[model samples]
Target: MLLNQVPVFIFLIILSICEAKQLLDEEFGTDDVTSGLCDDFFHGTPWPLPHDSKGRGLARLCQNQIEDGKEGRIVFATMFSTTERIPVYTANTVVLHRDGKEHPRPGSKYWYRVSLALCSSDDHTFDPIESMIGHAEKHEMEQCRKFQAVTEDYTHNGLNLDRGHLSPNSINEQDLEKQLGTFTLTNAAPQFADFNREVWRVYECVAQHTILDYVPGEKVYIITGTHGVALDVNNNPWWMNGDDTDMDKNPVKIPGVYWKAFCYPGNKTHSAWGYAIVQKNENVYRKPDYNEYITLKEFNTRGIITAPFGPSCMDASFGVFSKVFENWDEYIDTKCPSYTKKKREEL
Candidate 1:
């Protein structure tokens, strides 16, 4: 169908359907994330989804209501794993907090489940979305519970797991609707309390502050995700040996490692640069130390990360860069010493 000739509302509907087809196509997982799908949120160089050999992961364009009462503005994109009931990764360009003000958290019970009916539509020739694009109905939610994690999975389960967000709320605090978009259960994983509230939070802050402080107007794309699966205390340990999780027995897969990658696309003035960091999921009280941060080369060496920013900015390696740039004020100086020297020469 020719979309331009249709009414604006009809155009939107058709566009959404086309997007769904593109996102859910079987080959979408194998394609680079920067394949022009939701380029606005990805900054034209989105990170690729982690490998899902079982084909349980689905690509979703998360949307929320805008000022015009329309609900299709793409907030971010995620590769949600239906089997593990958590997002493998969420790729989004940071939307800085408005005027240094953070949005207050929403009331309790704000989580929503992805619409299983739409995701698992039998008429389509693509992988099922498992409802990350829309909210599921009561009956649909029940059916989804068989393969997806539900709100109840995190409640009173005797596991000290917090619903950790892949796409954090603080980065999107400027827009209430965008912040709320991060509350979906499909966008979360079972995170340890200490790790989630402590070091992981610090990592998120550093990534956000890196953009807000030094590179204020630059587009900084971030991809946060899980690496390995954690064993459930009550469930069989052998099940955790592989990527696949037994959803009926243990629906939520606590991630063994959490990682974040960020890219700053430089303009004509300077070249592009990006970094990645990883941390174990176990309890760690203090802030993340320098060694936790690594270059994209090291990230790929450790495995799971896929694709780079087209052989330029994304490919530049930080060979001997500092492990941690404690002060954001000195980030450009300490983190990018060579770049700093170049800037000094230009001055």
Candidate 2:
């Protein structure tokens, strides 16, 4: 199907073009954060299900919406359908709140109306999306329920496979071993190899070498998934270790609970700099800090944050560049990606 035939395509193209123009205008020192994604990105709340006309709603009690770079610290969202499935529209939303700053908090048992487009259903090969409709809850269960977790090899419906991050391998060992402990299978994702290999690496450097001071015992907890979460049994949204109080016999050890944080830099006391959970498929990692992003100046937005990590590093470690970049253009222009440069002794 040609783009000229679809109105949604027009929307994406128009937005892309506009974004391109905007980027061209301010080529150097881009502070613009296209923002985030699934699972850990939408924790502590009930995710909306697929609707009749609105596709699927992602509004939850604890979701931090993205922002429009052109608009000072405002949440932003987009609706698009793969060239294959036109009716199955995918609504991607992201928010850039100032950790330690004032902003809206997406807590548990809350209400939100972010995005819900009627997704298209025109499945075809290379149909504008290499990624398929990801599984929601059970997606990550392939290994979550299995003890002695398989760290290296894991898949979610076996789709857009990339550099699946299981532990703090050679890629993100930021000087601290326990902090790098997040590199466990419980902390992996289905990100593109280029993203994990090239771009996200830059963040590791900044997080380890650049941001020196941090609160001790600070840790990052992460979870990622598709569809609505059960808030039980599943391991994509929340993976708090040892939290089965209401049940008998501990079936899991990963932390399936929300940690703490403060607001980011720029904004008021709304959001925080704690676990910056990011994901591609059934995998999620607790981003201790979006360091590479700090230079972009994310301190002047939003207001408020109230969590344990409360926006500070919880004896945490490591960092990753955003994965919003879908293709080469993204890898080049936006991300200043680095790669695993660890020596033998470093490991």
Q: Which candidate should be chosen as best, given TM-score against the real structure?
A: 1
Expressed as tens digits, the lDDT of each residue in 261-335 for candidate 2 is 121222253222423332222233333233323211121121111121223433222222223222434433333
Candidate-wise lDDT, in order: 0.62, 0.27
lDDT of 2: 0.27
Worst 10 residues of 2 by lDDT: 110-119
How does each model score on TM-score? 0.71, 0.26
lDDT of 1 by residue, 197-298 (tens): 766776776676656655665666788888776654555431221333434344567788888877776778766777888887864465456556777766
**Regions of candidate 2 where Cα sits further than 4 Å from its true position:** 1-160, 166-180, 213-337, 340-347
Which candidate tops lDDT? 1
